[model samples]
Target: MTAPVDIERARFNMIEQQIRPWDVLDLDVLGLLNEVKREEFVPPAHKALAFVDMEIPLLPDTDEALKNGHCMLPPKVEARLLQDLAPKAHEKVLEVGAGSGYMAALLASRAQRVITLELHPELARMARENLQQAGIRNVEVREADGSKGLAAEGPFDAILLSGSVHEVPQALLQQLKVGGRLAAIVGDLPVMRATFVTRTGEAGWETRQPWDIAAPRLAGFPEASRFHF
Candidate 1:
């Protein structure tokens, strides 16, 4: 068993080696990566690998990965994407995956309000508890499909997905307030680029490739609904 002290040092090393070279330049983000105790959110059985470069399984291993909802993104990729979002104080944010509520907790430190949607009910509950334990009140963890996105309480200032998608969901794009940004890894396995799409104006969305990454595709997202399919 890796001692908590060792695990923390490894996390710092992971940030210096994997994230800094990836061009994540924000000092606050780099500091948060080291400050947040990721192992606290990971299942006890797998806590030892929290700082390792491999994905940590959050759900039971299943024949179909999409159905299992088990994969937690590597620490470096998670930190870099969070840095890209650059959440502002008091901004209403929407996050598509709650994973372990770790990402939402990070966003909570920077944003005013965060509504994080998680497809798995267990994960959602776990996220809620973790957020409370961490004393972060700015985030709301709910059980919902990321693809369907959040309805009713939207028009978000910034939206982020903790998983990948083959393409951006139009409904999600519609949910973003003008000038709001959305980030997700969009592409096939073994190779995918983290993409950031910003709503330039009411009718314009400009896409930019922020970084190269590999993340599991979010479950429940439909195939592009015909036009963009």
Candidate 2:
């Protein structure tokens, strides 16, 4: 018989090898990685792959999962994003693409509150259930199109797009409070950049590209028009 997987050691290796080297050196962020049981947030069928350096599908193995864009971000990507955003205890965060609610859980642990939106009905339900099961109360999971941003809950302190987009939507940018920051992976496949935008004024914004990272395309956003000529 095969020996059981060493859960704690795997978690350690994941942090030291995959996350730390990626410049996710924030002590608070690293500590949160240990405090939260990533294995529990993962789907049972994928529990063994939780700490691996790949995206874990939120749903069980199925073609529908691919079509629905339902998969958690890779460990290093998630950790790095969290460190960049650095949500504060007094801030309210908006997270687009609530894949399995793991990212929301991480944001909620730092921010005062987190509102995560998922487009797929089933995925939204799963996120809610997973967050509840993990006893994460500061997060509110909504079943809605995240591409447009939640105007009703406008003026968030920080916003995060959990997947890749050809460009950041203006609607989402308009939802940020002045002085607030928004992070997203922008540009098409094979060349996506981790773009960060800060709302500097009522109608002003400053943008920065700190690094490059590829992620699955998030559904619901409008695709850019292409020229045939």
Candidate 3:
């Protein structure tokens, strides 16, 4: 078992080395990264990988054949997404794919309130437990398919897809307030871009692809149709 001091050192190194190098320079975001104990959110079986620069599986045994495996995004990816989205203290945020609720915890620290949706019931329960243990009170973890976004409680200031999607569904964009921003990773395997969609007007939106990174697809999202012509 690693000592507490060692775990703290690893978390510091993760922020200074892995996350900072990826352009996540927001001081508040960095501070929140340190405030939240990532190891607690990580599965006990993989606790050693809490600060490692790779995705950490949330489940003890994830089926390889599963279409949407439950896992936490790499520390850098999560940090970068947070920095890019820039959730404000008074803003309401919506997060899709609450694996361990670590990301939701981060968002809740910055936003007024956060509503995260998870497809797996066990994962959803785990997320709620983790957030509660972490003393995060502004985030809610709901077990549901989040591909379509939560409309009834939406019109949020910011939205984030914690996992990759083949395409950002129009329904999600519509849930964003007129000036809200949404961040998502869009594309197929081998190549994917981190995209930001900002609602400019009642029906106008602008998109920008800032970087490339791949993540497991969020379950229940639509897959692009293949053409064999």
TM-scores, all candidates, are: 0.90, 0.95, 0.96
Error of 2 at 142 (Å): 0.5
The alpha-carbon lDDT assigned to residue 29 of candidate 3 equals: 94
Stretches off by above 4 angstroms in model 3 are 1-3, 63-67
Off by over 4 Å in 2: 1-5, 61-64
- Write the candidate numbers in order of decreasing lDDT: 3, 2, 1
Better of 2 and 3 by lDDT: 3
- Among these predictions, the greatest lDDT belongs to 3
Please list the Cα RMSD from the true structure of every candidate, rounded to 1 decimal place: 3.1, 2.6, 1.9
The weakest ten consecutive residues by lDDT in model 2 span: 60-69
lDDT of 3 at 186: 96
Model 1 clash tally, residue pairs: 0
lDDT tens digits, residues 85-116, model 1?
Answer: 77899699999989888889888888999999
Q: What tens digits encode model 3's per-residue C-alpha lDDT throughout 157-200?
A: 99999989999999999999999999999999999999999999
After superposition of all CA atoms, the RMSD between model 3 and the true structure is 1.9
Clashing pairs in 1: none
Query: In terms of TM-score, how similar is model 1 to the real structure?
Result: 0.90
